[model samples]
Target: MESIYLPTSYRSSKNLETAGYFEKYSKMCPLTWGGSSSDNFCRILEEMALNDFSEVDLSALGASCSINKLQLPSEPDNFPIEVPARLSTKSKLDFYYPVTTEATQLNVIKCKEALEKKWIRSEFKFGSKRSLKLTITDNMSNHFRNDILPGTNFIYSILIYRPFSMSMGQKHSGEKLRFAMEIEALGTNLLSQIIDAIECVSNYGVLKEVENTKVNLKQFQNAKQEYPSQTVFIDGVFYNDTRSPDAEDYSEPVIKWAREKNIGKFTVSAMETTLLNTLTPRIGYPYVYIHQGNCEHILTFSDARLIQPNDCLVSEKYPRIVSVCRSTNVLCLICGIAPSQWLVKKCDRFPQEKVFLCTDCCNSYLYIDGKKVGDFELYPFFDEKVT
Candidate 1:
């Protein structure tokens, strides 16, 4: 991906207003009026005129949850031309704005109301088909400040991914793909909400779940093409499903094609549509598990969610159950910093609740009584490993 270029001199009204808020707050007088709909911090940063502005490449952010460019092995027939970038408007707060309008003024008023009532946080949705959904936030924002804060008051944003498209092809077109973007503001103080919207966007945005309901699977299964049972050589490998009990059943061409190329690096026995994680079960839907990869993962459809956390432990109460993070708004018990994901260790002392340790805190060996006890290990459900 090419670097994003923005004007070096043009300051967005949002930034100017934020600077004004800080200025007025020092004198104990607060600004209570907002004029424009907010954009995500990423998009805001992209537009600002800064001499030393830099954007973090999503692809280089590593497998830690991010708004990454979606890549597929090969194009399948049912690929979505326009994905519904749904913006979730729910947050952990007392007030609620279940319905939102396209009007920017209404949203600004709604944000102000939430602040006046002492609401700590709120999320609003904005977007349509093929466009990125913006998760506009309203929160009493007291978070980290990077280089942009000193020069410009900017709204923070993060990329959110939800399972909406089924990728089957390896090659990608040169055209730039538009990802779902979410925006948030953190109110600095009681006045920040009225003056400058300083709501913070969560770095750990929600990844979409694949839509794999049983009804959808049945429809897909019934709609698949039937092929005669015969031995076929694909890529110099003998591809034969004739001996299987379900050999006569119709197969989706993508799965058959994947099998030919050994797409997921294993035998494709059964394609079951199931939720990826037990915790985030219904957030997204219909994830296609290619069955046995080198291992048995309930939601191993793509590389993003496939990689197991290095120090994660299995649930003693429920085997074969995988959870991405123990809690949604969890603070590292050892570090105090909020992480996108956590390395969860089962609490033998209290089996009901688990302990969350951030990667940095875990690396430092959070100590007690002269003993290092934060090292964690994975409880593998299967033996095979994939590169």
Candidate 2:
């Protein structure tokens, strides 16, 4: 991708506004009294006069997440686009705003009422089939400065990926393909860039799962195309069990694609969906998820509700087959950030919702997905290594 170029001088408000991204936030902020909306920190930086700007790469200070071309042998048919978020009349606190807007937007509450009455957010599509999408954030105002005070600020970010039209560096027939011309080359905060880098490297978790799912879909479709009545052999891979004796049954298994597969390794998927992790009572071969980790050995289940932490580890007195799923070898729920007791408590507060099972040995956790299991929960039930 070519470097993004902005004018050095802030001669035109339009140039300066777009350079720092004033429009994005302004759109996000709902307008009252018929004024402009607000954008987020990314946009704010985008609008910086090229002269005032030092560097706009990733980490906003260092090398960016910019890659010339990234190739994934297996990838999703469609990756969901991130909706752009606006600074609320309340968000004025989370970031710096236009000096002029700041003075008027200072009255956060009053502005909110006005935005609620007027402003509307617009959605932008990036992919050819409109497979990927983004929506401009509605604006908000806030009152915060200096202190680590949590106010009505909504943390926002953009969903980034290999844009469909983006030029792949590998040329075909001596011709090069071009990518999106408007992708902001300027990076965000240092921590954000770090997070981005982490995501870029670690996303194998989600990518593997998504690719596996897509492969399964392709196999199923292929089966239907070749022989409608035939059972779809889902590549016969270790992680392809999916609990069903046959996969051609459901139209869409509808699994939640991993949200944190920023790295490019293995996906931390549910035991049932992974290689060598399941049983096909009538079939010749059982399903599996592990190339090595024998998660199937200690996976236990119970009709009893496995809701509480106590359920994870039973006490001797009441332990007459509780839902304890353990492992002699290490198990990890390494998906996203490790959830805390406080976060668990929050889950408890909302019983209808799912709780994360990520723990010390487990790198990540997923709770209560379809079929009574969750995403990324490992089950040690595999008998042999998957080829």
Candidate 3:
């Protein structure tokens, strides 16, 4: 693939020397042509004439010669010096080749093309190809300044990954790109807006406290309102989502506990207090995003650029999802084919502590004629599928 050149301020010169500097000497010097031994005298004068001597008499060196008829020295057998061939050895630390900005961009383009081709050939189509639409609310529009126009604002590309472990201090292991989105309203948009745009499968997960109870998948339709607790940890401060009346401040308790333990001094604030552009977050640095109470995700700022005219003009589509991870459904342990809907725990029938089961398997294996078989806790299991 052809490498795309990035916009650069530096321009390379066509010639190293200044115009007419070396050409003047080349024409005047007799050494440039194969002249007699007496012409060596002129070479000495030519060198002096070339030097920065303003007081020197340049007319005394005689007129320049026409070298068209002058025969140059015959080529010597060892005229040009030859360099010893060195073995091309790389250091052990040099795992990857040093790539220029253009090369890096070309590699990225090729990878994207390959991924697109794979997506086209794959069986799963709908969820993997779909984009998340960000509806612009009236409140969001009200905050937009009249001075800041559509294309002038700074844009940010955020890459979010699924947290491998629930531990806050532990580094996220493995490579799993959950969401790749672009947001244009950096100055006007609040951190709360960005938090609201983030969607996770755990938000729709079912929770059951009682044992020997049937799990209802339909109950998740209104589960979002029941679990509105979310918090974003950026820099050293925690930004809590306090939009909903029932929304719990997950940061306050953590901040208080941290203060008590003398781990580190941290502050908690509402997500609406800070603007996206104001935060000086380092690109590729991992940040914590907790939503639906305990479901955590690692968020990182991938790239940032000024909004251009080619970008989407619609103000409603500012926070647009450009790329998404392919949907991967968790299969039932018993059936091994159907997607799991229920998570059964503490049952003697199952060997493991917890096992995923489809609705049909859960109904048949766990229950007998509409009555619970044993003391097993049942909860609805939401797969990692984005749809």
Candidate 4:
């Protein structure tokens, strides 16, 4: 297999000069107004300026134009024109705008101007497809400078991986990106404070269970009360969220199991006291996030950088989500259109052991005359959509 190499300047917008690309390209290309043929081009332009347009032979000048005779590079034979089939299913957010009409060109210019004046004060990188960067509005920056106390802060880009399912694990990559979020926080901020800001889809699952009469609502309410029983496994230690009185030490069992297997001793700490800057987090390394009693997610520190002048300066809005992935809904298996509300397990009627059904299908298929038809377990199914 042949690999195509892209220059660092071409791959990242950060490395490129902050000038018009066309001007740079023209300077680099010898034939484009920079070569010996420039004199002929200038003479033609001078002639056009002096002569009347109706009398000038435009066809003769067009034939003599140096730009028309310029040779351009052809595409490589092995260069892939179409994206790979495996990557076709992946979703992407497009930031590029094509100049199709004068109106559209004006709109693009206005959009850039808005970003410059209102949103981000610094140069915004527009070409990178893999990363999303956001900055505070100019008003927010001004407010922070005038009213807020000066302190050390950091911008963190976190990639949240999807919970593993049978299909998810079988895919090429075991980890599929559920969503990515960028947050701004002070270095003095507690780990627990940052964790609280992170909103998960599983949190909605507990509330969705209330819809199922088979399960007790009190159980879910109790679970919600114990929601702080979360842990973040960073480096070699586990940081447990023990703010609530009912918060359980979820790290004990895991540490015990690791010890039994002869793995190095792991220490557990209270997230409430641990500062965000105190921990050494490696970029792109997987960290374990256990929340809502065994709902696991792979959390990776995508980026960490010092706060800039353009960053959100409001202390109250610190640890706020700057960028988030679009929500995706899982449809019910039976109806195939409505969002799944119930999960049916160990049933003879359905082909699969576990099945997702909507409220209507669950009631109609699993019950008759206000009673369950078969000896099967029914639980509220919460789709992965973040409400």
Q: Indicate which candidate wins on TM-score.
A: 4
Q: Each candidate: what lDDT?
A: 0.28, 0.24, 0.60, 0.59
For each candidate, what TM-score against the reference?
A: 0.19, 0.16, 0.58, 0.60
TM-score of model 2 (CA atoms): 0.16
Give lDDT tens digits, candidate 4, residues 181-224. Answer: 55555655778877777766666647442324456544543344
Worst 10 residues of 4 by lDDT: 1-10
Model 2, position 330, has a per-residue lDDT of 19
Q: Going through the candidates in order, what is the number of backbone clashes in each?
A: 27, 80, 0, 0
lDDT: which is higher, 2 or 3? Answer: 3
Model 3 CA deviation exceeding 4 Å by range: 1-119, 123-151, 166-185, 210-220, 384-387
**lDDT score for residue 43 of model 4:** 61
Which one is best on lDDT? Answer: 3
What's the ranking of the predictions by lDDT, best on top? 3, 4, 1, 2
Tell me how candidate 3 scores on lDDT.
0.60
User: Which runs in model 1 stand beyond 4 Å of their true positions?
Assistant: 1-121, 124-287, 291-330, 334-336, 340-342, 349-353, 359-371, 374-387
Report the poorest 10 consecutive residues by lDDT, candidate 1. 378-387
Give all candidate RMSDs, comma-separated. 27.3, 27.3, 18.8, 14.5
lDDT-wise, the better of 1 and 2 is 1
Error of 4 at 230 (Å): 1.2
Error at 44, model 3, angstroms? 48
